[model samples]
Target: MEHSKIISAAMKINQLTDLNTYVIDNSGEFVFYHEDISIPAFMPGSGQEDVLNLYNQMMIQQMNQLYSYTNEWGLHYLGYSFSTNDSFAVIIGPFMYLTPDMYGLSREYNLRNNESEDLRSMCNQIQVLKTDKANSFASILQQFELLINKEAVPIRIVANKDNEKYRKRENNSIMNDDADIVTMRYKLEGNIMHAVEQGDKTTAIKLLNSNDMLFSFSERFPNQPLRRVKNLAIVLSTLLRNAVIRSDVPAIFVHRVSEKYAYEIEYSNQLSKLQQLYEGMVEEYTDLVIANTLTHYSKVTQKVIEYLISFYDKQIDKNELAELCFTHPSHLSRKFKQETNMTITGYQQMIRMNQAKHLLKNENISIEEIAWLVGYEDASYFTRVFKKETGYTPSQYRENN
Candidate 1:
């Protein structure tokens, strides 16, 4: 977390010439760096003086000189440089303290920002230095920054023996191209869906909040272009198709925000009508895909449904009813003609309107409460919508019948 530690690590790394180095600590913790890369550890467990004496003897035997040390916060950090910018460092703390988690983190700089490439190199250097303990490897990098460079890059040094998920994320995020952004979008979207399906709402929420999808979305669609309902619907449609074919859920949710927001703010009858436009595209296209009735309708229909359902409750969306009916949008459109039956938007409006009517008729709550309860942002709008749907304003209906 500290910036100084990373800078020190970078400075120390630039000072080291040979991959062969030794860390003999009396600090009561095992030292590890990269195995099969650097010299074996020669730990001389004794008092600091005795260890320093032995270090001196070993250095004299090798004809080396001039190590750097800093005393601050009641602890000491030392830097041993082989050249101007290629060396390593160490931080020593109190006699009784647990070492920090240092595995896979860049000690020479903070690994948080635009310096990922440099931090990655430092990680590689840690391996070359043969430091094995996650904490010790990280300690050297942290101390290296403070001792030599005077700053640290934001980096984490957690040890992952076999997992390469981060590696995939980083690799997939290369370049700010549409393909790259879409890849990240689909990957994260799929991840969130899987989490949700597994009844891991916590994990799903965490994945959503992790900024990975946010970054991808922002990068791909600047000025919040996806904020528009129509644009978002199209993206969702595209992504849903991709998800169903590729079985990617992250992509589905990533593009469903438009539909989500529409559903969220559908209380105004006028807006509810507008929502039909968005819902129409999603349902029609998805049904085509699910039914496989058309050449264009691939497996993408399920993904679109998944995307919409993720943001809207299943009860309100009538997912079970939609699935059981096997009703294609076109078939219903032809049959209902003027009735507006089976269109995606029509179904959505029907559900919203039904809920509104129930709240108005069954409860003594104010129209404003009903507006919000049914997802409208404006009470007056809900009034107009109620009038259009039922031939009377909410108050007028209550007054007459």
Candidate 2:
């Protein structure tokens, strides 16, 4: 039930945004998007650095590593980001066990047949009656709605009419008119189809991986398993073949190859059952990879985090952590940033502030003691940092609460 809750919650929260979100800090956690509500002309804060941090957090929390397993199947993590230039890159990790491979495409089947016939007939009529961009948008929306209602896959749709910035991002240049956006998608799709025809697997794969691919294909075919199956199966197959040929592919990828290919190549129930077994292996060990990352370093940063959490509000010296984690001043700073996305001092300060919020709400601890506990020997300095974090002083917070 706990596992189910986490999965459902993760899927539920994914509907809000297109930004790559993450569930950080611990295992099997929920990924969330804190919407960046700002004017179009304004630049996002801190550029791509925060984006990378968020991605890392999501990867770590979802156990979206190569060695993690689902309950019954093994899986691999393919992380990619599509760009304005219509190019992207992926980070393929080692494979891990996940869930058993079920024979039927349950989600796809539901998506295909779940729409009311009346509404379905209406969609068909709309697709035929209107030759303009609006009808095209409506058709895409209906298909997207069906996919969302049935399969629970999170997708974002921004009409070219309302989203000029997104259009610029997709096309890599400013657009003069809405028709241009439609033309751009058409052109991109043509490029994708051309690549597919020319046996350019790399370009074809890139197009198929885009948000637009999912949109266009889902609308065009409406839940046909063959349309969906070829992409996933082919990618897994390619990864497997590559691993075998290269000899450097991880054990998990080899296992997936053996399992998926057995089903594709042999087509026996026994092989299918074996595929399930392999999938489970992928999910489980992928989680193990993420778990190992937390304790992966036998070094000081982990010690610093653990010690600070244990101490709660207690003040400990930076020098004390150096001895405890066996890290020198500069190296410790570097290590914390490398692993945790924040400087050691910054993390400690965040910890102190979070702990202070909890303590002030529950306990009768004074601001001064809370300061001392969080390693700030001076009450004034503690107050300053606290205000910086929460926008309220200790007394102010306590009084307001």
How high is each candidate's TM-score? 0.23, 0.25
- Lowest summed lDDT across 10 adjacent residues in model 2 is found at 64-73
Per-residue lDDT tens digits for candidate 1, residues 152-186, read 44443322122253334334434544564465565
RMSD of each: 23.6, 25.1
Best by the TM-score measure: 2
Q: Model 2: per-residue lDDT, tens digit, 341-378?
A: 88766776776786577557654657876675456668
lDDT value, candidate 1, whole model: 0.40
> What is the lDDT of every predicted structure here?
0.40, 0.41
